[model samples]
Target chain A: MKLFQDKISSAASRVRIALALKGLDVEREAIGILGPDALNRKPEYLQLNPQGLVPALLTDEGVLLTQSLAIIEYLDERYPEPPLLPGKLEDRAFARTVALAIAADIHPLLPPRVTAHLGMIGVKAEDIAEWSRHWIRVGLTAVEELLARRQTGQYVAGDAPSMADICLFPQAINAERAGLPLDQWPRIAAVVARLREIPAFADNGPAPRS
Target chain B: MKLFQDKISSAASRVRIALALKGLDVEREAIGILGPDALNRKPEYLQLNPQGLVPALLTDEGVLLTQSLAIIEYLDERYPEPPLLPGKLEDRAFARTVALAIAADIHPLLPPRVTAHLGMIGVKAEDIAEWSRHWIRVGLTAVEELLARRQTGQYVAGDAPSMADICLFPQAINAERAGLPLDQWPRIAAVVARLREIPAFADNGPAPRS
Candidate 1:
C-alpha cells in the first residue's frame, strides 16, 4: 500500500495515526503542497486523487481511497483486529459525528489553499487568522460538548481510541498551530492528553515533512 | 425518525434524498437558518447537534446522528433493504470518495454562514458570489473528472444509485444555485440526470420551505 501525504496536514495525519493504530506497514511519499502547490495538481497525482487532496491511499488492490475518514474506516474494516468504530449503532453515530466535527468544520477552514483564497479575495491576513481561530474554537467547543457526553470514555467516543480520536487529535494539533488555546475546552484537552500518550498517535503524527 | 433540516441546504438535502431512497418515512422540520445568523447555535438545537449543522436525525432509538454521510450510512445499515454503499470493497471506497468530493469539498464552501463570514470580513457581496462560483466549479470539475473515469456507471460507482449519487445530486443543484453553468461538466450532468429520474430523488429534494 502507498500513501501520498503531507507531514503536517491534519487529514494526512489522521490517516497516519490510523495506519499506526492498525499496525499497517505502508510506503509514504511526501507530496510538496506547502510550496507552490501544483505538485499535487500534476497529471499523475491528479489521476490518483481527482480533487488533488493530499493523503490519498492507493491500496494493494490498486483502488485509491480519498477522504481521511473513508480511508481510515477502510483500514479498520480490512484489518479488524482492533475496531476504531464502536460496536453499537448509536456509539458509531456519535464517533462519526465527533470525527466529522473536526474533519469538516475545523480542518477545511485553515487549509493553506483556503487561507490563500481568503487573502486573494481581500480578507486581511490578520482577519484570516481570526477566521481560522474562531472556527477552530467553535469546532473544539462542539468537540468538548460531544466528549462530555455520557458515552465518553477515556477516548472521545468509547473505551478504545476510535476514529473519533484519530480525527480529533490531528485537529487539536492544528488548532494549536492556529493559536487557539485548548485549555478552554477541558474535555477536549483531556481526550487529547490521553490520545497523545498512545504509541500510534505519538509515533506517527505531524512530524516535519521529509 | 425526525430530520432537522433547511429546505435549500445542500448537505440537508443529501440526507433527505437518502432517506427517500431508503423508503424510510421521516418527519422533517425546517430549521430557519437563512434568516438570522446561527439558528443552529440555539441551545435546544445545539444540544442535539453541537456543531450546529443541519440535517441531524433523531432515531426512534433516541440517538442523534449528524453529518449527512454518517446519518445516511447509519440508516442504510439499520434498514439494509437497498444498500447505498456498493457490495465490493473497492467500489465502496469510490462511492465514499465521490460523496466527500461534495460533502467535504463543495458544500462547506457555499454554506450561508461561511459567505456571511466573508462579508463580515470585507469580501464584497459580488466577490462572495465569485468565491462560491469558483469553488463550486472547482469541486464539480473534480467530480466530472472522477465520473469520466473507467469505473463510470449509470450512477457514480456502479449500476445502482448509491451514496455518491445522493451527495452528488444536491451538489449539482447547489452549483446551479451558485450561478455556475453545469454544462461544462457533461458527465456529471448526465449522471445527475439519471439519478434525478429515480422516485426517491424526485420525491424528496430541496422543496421550498413549508
Candidate 2:
C-alpha cells in the first residue's frame, strides 16, 4: 500500500492518523500543492488522481481511493482491530455526523484553494481572514453544542477516539491556525487535548513540507 | 420514522431519495429554511439538531440522525434489503469517494449559507454568481474525470444505483440551478439522465416549499 500525501494537508493528516491508529504501514509520497512546482497539477499526478488532491490511497489490489473520509472508512473496514466507529448503529451515525460537519461544512471554507480563489476575485486579505474566522466560529460552536448534547464519554462519540475525533483534532488545529481560541469550544478543547496525548494523533500535527 | 426537511434542500433531497430507494415510510415535516419563519433556527429544531440543518431523521428508536450522508448510511445498515452501497469492499470505497467528492467538496460551496456569508462580506452579486459557477464547474469537472476513469456501469459506481448516484443526482440538479450547462461534463450529464429514470431519484427533484 502507498499514500500520496502532502504533510500540510489536514485531509491527508486525517488518513495519517487513521493509519497510525490501525498500525498499518504504507509507502508515502509527498505531492506539492502550492507554488510554481505544484506537482498535484502535473499530468502524471492528475492521471493518478484527477481531483488533484492529496491523500489518495493505492490499495494492494491497485485500486485508488480518494476523499479522506472514504479512505479512512476503507482502512477501518480492511483493518478492523481498532474500529474507528462505535458499535451501535445510532452511535456510528453520530460519529459520522460530527465528521461530516467538519469535513464538509467547516474545512472546505478555509482551505488554501478556496481562500486563493477569494483573493483572485478581489476579496481583501483581512476580509478573507474574517471569513475564515467566521466559519470556524459558527461551525465549531455547533460542534461544541453537539458534543455537549451527545457525548457519552471522554471523546466526541464515546469512550474511545473514533472517526469524530479523527476529524475534530485536525479541524481544531485549523481553528487555532485561523486565530480562534480553542477554549471557545471547551468540550472540543478538552477532547482535542486528550487526543493529543495519543501518539497517532500527535505525530500527525501540521508540519513543514519536506 | 419522521424526517425534518425543507423541500428545496438538495441535501434533504439526498436523504429523501435514499428513503424511497429503501422502500421505507416516514412522516414528513417541512421546516422553513428561508424567510422570517425559518424554523430551522427555532429553539425546538436546534434542540433536535444543533447544527440547525434540514433533513434530520428521527429513527424508530428515537435516535435523531443528522447529516444526509450519515443518515443514509445508517438507513443502509439498518435496512439491508436494497443495499445503497456495493457488496465488495473496493466498490464500496469507490462509491463513497464519489459521494464524498460531491457532498464534501462541491455541495458545501454552493449552499445558501455559504453564499450568504460571501454576500455579507461584500462580494458583489455578480461575483458571487461567478463564485458559485466556478466551484460547480471545477468540482463537476473532477467528478466527470473520476467517472470516466472508474465507472464500471451505467451508474456512478456500478450497474446498480448506489450511494454515489444518490449524491450525484441532487448535485446535478444543483448544478443546473446555478445556470452552468450540465453538458459541460458529459459523463455526469449521462449518469444523471440514467438515474432520473428511477422513481427514487426522479421523485426527489427540488420542489417548492409547501
Candidate 3:
C-alpha cells in the first residue's frame, strides 16, 4: 500500500493518523504541492486521483481511495481490531455528525479560494476575517452542543479514540494556523489539546512541509 | 419518521427517493425557504439541525440526522430488507465514489454563492460556466471510468437501486438545471437516463425548482 500525501494538508493528516492507529505500513511519498515539481498535477498522479487532490491512498489490491472520510472508513472496516468508530448505530451517527460538521461546513470555507474570491468581490480582508471567525464559531458552537449531550470521555466517542476525534484534530490544527480565535471556543480547543496528548494522533501527524 | 425538506433542492429529493425505495412512511413538510415561515431559519429547526440546512431527518427514534449522505446511510441500515448498497465492499466503495463525486464536489461548486461571488470578481459568466463545466466534466469522467471497469447492470451497482443511483439521479437533474452541455458526457447521461426510468428515481425527484 502507498499514500501520496501533503504534509500540511488536514485531509492527509486524518488518514495518516488512521494508518498509525491501525498499525498499517504504507509506502509514503510526500508531494510538494506549491513547489516546482507540482507533483499533484502530474499525469501519473492525476491517474491515481482524477480530482488532482492530495491524500490519495493506493491500497495493496491496487484500488485508490480519494475522499479522506471514505478512506478512513475503509481502513477501519478492513482492520477492525482497533476500531475507529463506535459500535452502536446512534453513537456512530453522533460521531459522523461531528465529523461532517467539519468536513462539509468548516473545511470547505477554509481553503484560500473562499477568502481570495471574497477579496475579489470588494470584501475587505477584515470582512473576510470576520466571516471566517463567524462560521468557525458557528461550527464550534454546534460541536459544543454535541459534546454537552455526551459523556465527557477521553475521546470524542466515549473513552476510545474514534473517527470523530480523528476529524476534529486536523481542523483544530488548521484553525490555529488560520489564526481563528480559540479563546471563545474553549470546549473545542480543549478537545484539540486532549487529542494531541494521545500518542497515535501526535505521532502520526505530518511534520510541517517546508 | 419525518423529512423536513424543500421542493427545489436536489439533495432533499435524493433523500425522498431513498425513503420511497425503503417503503417507509415519513411525515413530509414542504418548507418555504423564502417565505415568512421559512423552516430552515426557525430556532426549533436550527436546534434540530444547527447547520441550518434542509433535508434534516427526524428518525422514528427522534434522533436528527442532518447530512444527506448520513441520513441515507442510516435509513439503509435500519431498513435492510431492500439494501441500498451493493453486496461486495469494492462495489460499495465504487457506489460511494460516484456519490461523493456529486455530493461533495460538483454540487458544492454549483451553488449560487459560488458563481455570484465569482461574478463579483469581474469574472465573465462564460468563465464561471467554463469553471462549472470543468468540474462537471472531471467528475463525470471519473464516474465513466468507474463504470467502464464495472459490469453494466440496472444501476451503477450490480442490479440494485443503491446509493450510487440515488446520488446520480439528483446530480444529473441539477446539471440540466445548471445548463451544462450534456453532449460531451454521453455515458454519464446514459446512466442518468437509465436510472430515471425507475419509478423511485423519477417520481420522487425534485421537479425543476426555478
The DockQ of each candidate is: 0.66, 0.86, 0.35
TM-score of chain A of each: 0.93, 0.95, 0.86
Candidate 3: pairs in clash: none
Clashes of 2: 0
C-alpha lDDT (0 to 100) for residue A79 of candidate 2? 95
**Scored by Cα lDDT, where does model 1 land?**
0.81
Question: Which window of 10 residues has the lowest lDDT sum in candidate 2 chain A?
Answer: A34-43
Q: For model 1, what TM-score does chain A reach?
A: 0.93
On lDDT, the stronger of 1 and 2 is: 2
For each candidate, give the interface RMSD after superposing the true interface residues on Cα: 1.6, 0.9, 3.4
Per DockQ, what order, best first?
2, 1, 3
For B1-210, candidate 1 gives per-residue lDDT tens digits of: 999998777788888888887788888877767766657456788766656678889899887788888888888888897899998877887888888878887777777788888888888899998998888888888878777763557888899989988988877876766567678888888887887788788766665422
Show the lowest summed lDDT stretch of 10 residues, model 3 chain A: A32-41
lDDT per residue (tens digit) for residues A27-103 in model 3? 98876555434654578776656556767788878887777877887788788979988887767877776777676
Docking class of 1: medium
For candidate 1, what is the DockQ?
0.66
Candidates ranked by TM-score: 2, 1, 3
Per-residue CA lDDT of model 2 for B1-210, tens digit only, reads 999998889889999999999998899988768764465457887777767788899999988888999999999989997999988899999999999989988888877788877888889999998998898888889889889888988898888999999999988887887787789888899999999899999998767433
Index of the highest-TM-score prediction: 2
